[model samples]
Target: MTGERYPTTAEVVTGARELTLRYPDLCHLGVVGRSRAGRPLLMLTVGNGSRNVLVVAGPHANEAAVGGATVLRLAALIAATRQRGEDDGSAWHFLLCIDPDGAVLNEPWLHGPYTLRSHYEHFFRPCAAEQPEWLPHSGEAEAAALPETRALVGVLDWLRPVLQCSLHGIDVGGSFVQLTSEVPGVPERISKSAAELDIPLERGSSDAFQWPSPGPGVYVMPPPDDEVAVGDGAHSTWAHARRYGVTAIVEVPMWACDRAADTSPHPDPEQALRIAGAALRRDLPLVAEVLRAIAPQLGGGDCALLRTVRELVALGPRLTADWDPAVRALDAAPLPPMTNARVTSIEVYAQRVPLRAAAMLRRIADVPLVARLVDEWCAAYERAYSPRWIPVADQVEQQARSVIAVYEEMHV
Candidate 1:
């Protein structure tokens, strides 16, 4: 497995090709699509089973370790299925690094001492509009889907697998899972693998506050939000996949939060949401101001770096629209005891957004203003939370275990 050192996108594709040579009968490697930056998107098919299970990773660039985990999972699934009875029709496909362009931008931290500082410092995430999960719209006025998206669309259309599991991850937090439809007992079984590795379930992680959860770690997946420019269900990956198979999303963090397991009811849920929202809302304008002052000097840099900086700075008011609504909705929904996790999420939310803004400025880190902001942001995070680097092996193992748990439970 990748262990502590994560694999680059090229290494992942190369590994899959090597595996194909090792197991010619069961493994097939082929290019499915191309990225805007002209990287070939490769998919590795393993097992001879009639029914297929499509697995994808690296839809987001920052989740470097998850991309590494995908390769591990590909190897593990092949070995597991190879040992199973011939009657077991459980084919699997691995889509290696959908965002290869973005992956290149993150290679700086892929082989790491695994500090949050180094991570954000070198991190790069294309805005949502650029992510492959969104399908291209028909109208010329509507943004086109990335080529990676079209390749996936073709794969999904052809395979129409019984299950499509997208592997995702975070830099710091606990394990969180999302499924298009709930499979009985998967949550119970899924939690053990990560927990044993000291990764708690993040009951209060801030990403999908709007979705319903079956338990602390698993959220019932929802369709893409058009408001965010992600197309509606009819045009989104989840919707397209759901037509043929159920979708499972497994998210494991490279860093763990001890407080994530605590489910005690928060004393002030609205307050927590408000504070987190306020900080995020405050960052956009502040970032814009800085860029505005430095605009004359700001020329071309890392396209990934420049894109994120521009998006965050120009992010409209809608950036935090959900935060206040989330605060208001709290009374109606009654916050689910993220007490510890939720409170910690407040700090996480507050710090993470600004860190992202500062992270994009790493291209210009030589600039005194950018360097100071980066240092300040990094220092604040360090002071508030100790850097606890989760091993790549553990993270990959948890992901494998979680996927296997769901696959086994669903297969039955």
Candidate 2:
């Protein structure tokens, strides 16, 4: 078994190379690209077969856990498979570190004592344009069009992987996983695996969480509209892979580990790594199973829900005018390029409009279906705005009660 310790990116590379040298027939190393500081973006191939699986990490600088865990796990997997004297000979190729520039910027504070607030302020506050991961350059037309992206794009084009998982972490919130393409039976398997690991199953993006009862793998939410653009350009792995006939594209949240007891600081980094590593080792097989089940129905659904969401956002300014003038002011202001005005409006409504909606729901429309839809939508909004699901639900319910009390007082 690999040592239960946190390995730096350099150490991971050295260790991977050493493992490959020891098991020449089973392992090989390839340079995909270089970071801004000229660190090699390495790709490691385990097993001799042709089934390529690509895992990318550290697309965003602050989300280092994804990349860190991925490299360490890849190294460990290679070593273990070789020692077992079992060359399964599956062609499993991993683009282990896709964003070395972002990873490096985050490495300095890996073992530091900075609070989440300070960490965000120091390392994550940069606008996407300023970020090396998102900023576009001469050859690329998106933010963070670094050399690392080019190498990744090249590999995806060459390999045409069957599965692509991009690992990311949220600073605060319950754990969740996202799949671009929904597969049959996959949701249940993911939920079961996450439950075993003690992580909740979520759906959609983090912005909207009106997930139905059988959630995917964590909370079901929608991605903010602005974040969508980050996935559109050439620098985006999802966009590039889809073009290359790649089937499964998922973003796995780091916090959603079976063993991640809490997002709070762990007294033992080794234990944390072990828990996370074990979770991945166990979950990947489940993920592979889901991929096989969903392969037939690829690209089947009409993304009408997403389109409806866009329409609702476009109508937000008009809706907010009667209740809050600040909405108009914000809409009229010269906002930054990447800011999503709609999301801001929804956030404001989460803080202010629930009471009015609750009263209106109770009074104007007592129809069960409409009321239920309204309640579910409101709950979803609350879940998105607040990190803790229970408290956010409680506060929203209290506001609803207050609205009812006010209506009764006015009547009296």
Candidate 3:
């Protein structure tokens, strides 16, 4: 648990397997699925009873920190549970590495001497299409279907966990966690945990603008407008959980846990695991608390919002002029300067607002008053610009950037 800097993926997996074997009474480990290249999608279950908490890491290969950390944390948790003999009837299960292929793609950098710019250029920046995790399958292609996706889907369906966490991380800046707005009280608990660990809360994910004075450590990302469910995609594990009545949390570890100051070198595998373990230990209790509070409304809500999001993406280029004024206003307002990153963030927001407004209308199915309010908001935007005023391509690009900002705000 406390030696060396970074551990290789093979080393981490081997260690995890050993832990499961060493503590069979407290843990159940197995291959729930396979990656595209046929590597086992390893899973570990700790504790006993029907009430389960699910954690997933390595959804994207580049973000292997989450998987490594989760494995180590599971080992520690199992040890603690055995010593205490606390049969609380609550179990924690994890899909330790959901995308081994993707993770393997990032193995060269896992050991250390992390270079942010180099890593971004060599690995992370390409769109989902270029990434194994995001590629869609076709009937005729030989390498069409990804083993990782199939394996994950099967396990998720079988387990149907009460609460799920999909682990991910960013290259630059502070640590942040992502959760659905539907999960009430999560933001505060997460913020509290981050403060305890001295990790600054990021107001949003990578796409969001950095605040003028980003407070010392990690911060919570801002929430999207109440009506719109803006996020990566409906295809994500988090979105899948929403469909199946589970509360999901996406943990984004920007850097090692112990190295709070931005000065330290990226942790080696050993150090990274230690950092990850500490974070899960510190934050798990808060996750449990949030789940308890929102149990009643877990999977009961209007799903139409997802459809509206898709429509907005399709209509974005056409909605350019309508959103330009708002974007300009946001830029002019007392906020951070519009860096290339920030510009992208603003565009994402501009694209999402209209979609959210539409979704709000559908949400208030029976409440005429609320529906009327949403309609009025939508109409006002509709009247704000002429169809031909802004080029469709430019509008679409701007909206895309705005969506990124909204995500940053939510993560921070």
Candidate 4:
């Protein structure tokens, strides 16, 4: 299976170029820009029509593998349709591997047997503000702070697509979709596709609870004007895409767990969330201690990886911060609704403390003491979480088909 696994960042670039050459008229390969690491960022335009659609994938490095596969597959599908003279004024522009540097960092895990432990070992998710796809920029403010991010903004500015889909995946959780607008028939198509693939639909999370679901597995994407949108106005892909037309975020699960879909009401949900937050807050000191203890041994090598881990550790406190007031605010608000899925998700997060800490620890911890600590932490996390990992191929198939189904519905 590993031999036939998804393509890497380089392979994606190569494949895009080859596709353009093969379908000269239907496909046009162009450079968006270079990545931070000077890797060529390419886009493959798959149709020659007025209705522009932008499909972006591998915005997050860790997600590059499967996301790249999906993009490539979709490009081929669109190209075949175009070759057959089936194009009905639908043009697609594919931004392939926006964050090549990040993808390089995560290239080791592109092949299958993508377990949670393996994924966490090579995991690297940049801060919301720092990520190439999530950077803050409004209406051409000179240039975006990150070149990788700026390239994407440039494409959006040039295309002004009527439909946009950002390909993304979660390390865990069931399949879900976030749409800028509730387009007719799209949600039903997503539900049907995911059902056929046997991907469990994400039931209810507090984040999605605020927005009503048009159908199963689909949530109304929070708008830029929403108070919850990060970094004022320029952080989300949805923010930039909304000015043009509908934007969709298709989040297929990397792994499946039945518990992720449980929607039964939990007793005293607000207090439970508070308790979980408190537990996370309490774990901060231990995380800092471990980081401090292993700092000397980590050395100067792998600066990029080290910086990412440092950022992750730093984020722990800021996220933990100022929650007590919010918790109290929630407590007073006439018992907010809660679901078993939400509670279980929180429980999973709580159990992830040691594992998350260990992920950082393993990267810099060449020492026997630190290695032992990682092992102990992993064992503890496994005991608590009881992770049941589904095959990576299953997830990939489910995601690609689900997204394609939505795209088909969009065109219809």
Candidate 5:
């Protein structure tokens, strides 16, 4: 019932409390830890079975579809099973929004005419360096860690749950599942659920983060030693994976299309990636330079969001340099036949984070150059990608169902 549109932070918290109030014997609500902004970090516990499982969302702010939407949906599903005397003997622990402060910044589009325009217009994600889930792995730095990270760590230590699912979502594309440890039938189960829900499996590589894809829609988490460079560092899903049975990072697309999973060989293999690389090479440097120039104008005021905008914009040249050369090599390699997923990867995935950063910068500062850039890019998205909005209900269903499907597999 909570998934027609994304639930706001208040609505999510209230729902958890209400669930606990209505079924006090079955629901246990407790404060996990306080967030950086002094918000109480809440965790809702359901069932008293032997297996302790943790499902959390809101590690990335703007991914609200899975933030509270999936968590609440998962709760409702499990609760219904209990009412039907279908208990599975697995205690489920849930965190609706692990990063409450960051999530609050994304509430505007949560109650929306969900669209690419509306989403980018209101998007906000913390810089990678500053994300609570990926802080550097240094004992000395632990003291200065963001409270959100500490809160997450606190819960992880306390639960020591054998199974964990840290939920996430993409603005576009289709269902992709990541595992710190594999469950034999999980990938097939995810594909079946996606097909049933009409969400395709997004098998293409993402521009933002690339991991080892071992199956149709499954990504294997990189080893912990390489975690800092390729995956979430110090305190994250990987941390839980080391101490738990299997940690799953389940991602569902906010928008979907059959093209996401299409395997038909593309007419011009590698063209879309090359084109995307070219566009990034041509435009990123200019945005980076302009933002670098005006950065000092924001004197005496600095926080995560401002720092994130500046850092990502400044990183444009490096991003383009790395991307262009890699894609160019694809031109020479005897690569497998291209597919429609390549177009989805290039048009939507490649430009997602940077474009979102551009929109965010304009919101923070109305610089003419930045504003013009964002306007031009938005037009390009409409003309090239045809950004369709996947209904919120579909996203919630896919995310929640995927988690449950895997849990049921573990049970069996």
Candidate 6:
């Protein structure tokens, strides 16, 4: 078991290979697919129960290691307990480190100070559309189906497991879960695990857009958006929910404090949507202004950092240019029944936007203008965020336990 430590793609691969080799009678390793950068994606199966449970980790580069660690621990746990029929006749599949190229890019800070600053300094997450989990936008022109995603789709088709849990981690906010439906007792198991780990539950507005929650910290999974979803059922979980029994997404947070769990009354969903949309619209021009002022001097750049800056400069407008229209459509949609959970959308965005922007700018710190921008932007973002981080060990352990708890309920 990997415990609380995050590992690099190579480390995860090596560990999986070792486990399968050490427990030949209990588990076997298989190559899932090659990543975009040609790294072999591996899946390890441990158990021989009647039912199949598929657990995926590290689909997103930045969030991969924590989930990778969790699933590995879960595999060992399942192996230990299921010898006594503890898993209710269920075999487990673990997909380790899906996007190796992107994950390797962020491996520098895995064992260290574990501070927000250090993480951002070493972090890199692809835009949502480009992410392996949501790629091949069945119908979009922006991103084609990635090799990693295609492999995952094939696994889903071949196994059609009864439960699919995609392990994910958040940069900010508290812990939350996304389920295809309200699985009986699963929410309670998740809430209990969060409490045991001392991680606060995110009872406020979620970033799942307009998706409604059946209970505190448990949201009903929504369809893939126009930009990210390819067909009617493009997302792996969404596409297979009907054929399979259920899918649960466990989102572990990188940082959380009591404020993250606040359930105070706030604006309605519609109003919160508009508020967030307005911020996006407002921030675009400012981001563009910063890009414009620095563009000419950036032309001589000959590094990945410059290329990312160039992409962001071009991709920023393309990504956010339609906020105004999107908000209008959001306003037109029917509102869900009200609840006391706070509308933390703007709060989350206030932190997310600047923090992420600062991270991007930090990558090109050798450039004088970019370095200056990074300092100013990061300071402003910190002031606005005023975040208190949950201990790293607590966060990682909570996620591992959360998965175990959910899996237990599924077999019951």
Candidate lDDT scores, in order, read: 0.73, 0.43, 0.44, 0.69, 0.72, 0.66
Q: What order do candidates take by TM-score, descending? A: 1, 5, 4, 6, 3, 2
Task: State how far residue 265 of model 5 sits from its true place (Å).
Answer: 4.2
Poorest 10 consecutive residues of model 1 by lDDT? Answer: 225-234
RMSD after Cα superposition, model 1:
3.2
lDDT of 4 by residue, 56-119 (tens): 8887777777778877788887898889889788789988888877777777766645565566
Report lDDT (Cα) of residue 74, candidate 4. 83
lDDT tens digits, residues 136-210, model 5?
456656777778777777777777777788788887677887777666677788888888888888876453244
Error of 3 at 62 (Å): 1.1
From the highest lDDT down, the ranking of the candidates is: 1, 5, 4, 6, 3, 2
Runs in model 4 with CA error above 4 Å?
1-4, 137-144, 206-209, 229-234, 268-275, 296-302, 318-336, 352-354, 368-388
lDDT of 6 by residue, 185-228 (tens): 76687788788877778775444535566666777655545423
Q: RMSD to native for every prediction? A: 3.2, 21.3, 20.2, 3.3, 3.1, 4.1
- What's the lDDT for candidate 2? 0.43
Please give the clash total of every predicted structure, in order: 0, 21, 48, 0, 0, 4
- The digit string of per-residue lDDT tens for model 2 on 191-247 reads 454444444333323233232223444322223233432233333455456544333
Residue lDDT tens for model 1, 1-46: 3366788777787778778887787788888988898888888888
Candidate 4 local Cα displacement, residue 143, angstroms? 3.8
As for candidate 6, its clashing pairs are 58-64, 136-145, 137-230, 138-230
TM-score for each predicted model, relative to the true structure: 0.89, 0.53, 0.54, 0.87, 0.89, 0.83
Could you give me the TM-score of model 3 versus the true structure?
0.54
> Model 2, 373: alpha-carbon shift in Å?
38
Give the Å error, residue 103, model 5: 0.8
